[model samples]
Target: MNQYLISIYQPDGPTPEPEILEPIMRDVEAVNAELREAGAWVFAGGLFPPSTSTVLRLKDSEVLTTDGPYVEGKEHLGGFTVIRAADLDEALAWGEKVARAITLPVEVRPLQHGACQ
Candidate 1:
C-alpha cells in the first residue's frame, strides 16, 4: 500500500452556524468511519486556527522562530489525513469523498516513502 496525504483547506470566513454545520460534521465523520473500516485510516485531525501557529526557519545554523504561518493567505490548512491506498487512483477517490464532506478542496499527494506499507 502507498500512503497519501489529504490536505483540507479552509477559507478565511465566518464559521457556519450550527444548524448548517451539524450535517457537514456528520458527513465528515461518516467518511472517517469509512476510512477506518477500509483500513485506510492512519490518522487525521482538525487543526487550531492559523493564528495559533508558529513558524521556524534555519538561518546560518540558527533556529529562527516567528508567529503565524510560513505564508499568510486567505485560506489555510484546516486539517489533514494520512491514508493508505493501493494507488493514486484509490487515493484520489478518497480525496473526492473528503472534499464533499468538508465542502472544500482536498490536496492528495503520495508520500515518497512508505513506512507503514
Candidate 2:
C-alpha cells in the first residue's frame, strides 16, 4: 500500500468558536478511530497556531531562521493524517472523509516510495 498525506487547510485561521469546533473535533476523532480500526492510520495530529511556526534555511553552511512560515499566504496547514492505501483513489476517499468531518479543504498527496520508512 502507498502512503498518503491528508492535510487540512484553512484560509481564515482555525475555527473561531468552540461551539462550532467541538462537533468537528468529535468527527475528527471518529475518523481517526475508524482509520486505526481499519489499519490505515499511520499518524495523525493537529498543528499549533501559525504564530508558533519558525522557518529555517541553510545556505553555504550558514543557517538562517525566521519567525514565520516560509511563504506569506492566507491559507496554512492546520493538521494532517498519514494513511496507507492501495492507490490514489483510496487515499482520496479517506481525504474526503476528513474534509467532510472538519468542513475544511483537504489536500491528499502520495508520499514518495520508501519515504515513510
Which candidate leads the pack in TM-score?
Answer: 1
Model 2 over residues 19-81: C-alpha lDDT tens digits? 988998899999999899999999988888788899889989999998978888888898999
Tens digit of lDDT per residue, candidate 1, span 60-109? 99999999989989999999999999999999999999999989889999
lDDT of 2: 0.91
Once superposed on the true structure, which residue ranges of model 2 sit more than 4 Å away at CA? none
What TM-score should be assigned to candidate 2? 0.93
Clash total of candidate 1: 0
- For each candidate, the alpha-carbon lDDT, in order, equals 0.93, 0.91
**In model 1, where is the ten-residue run with the lowest total lDDT?**
108-117
Model 1 residue runs over 4 Å out of place are: 115-117
Clashes of each: 0, 0
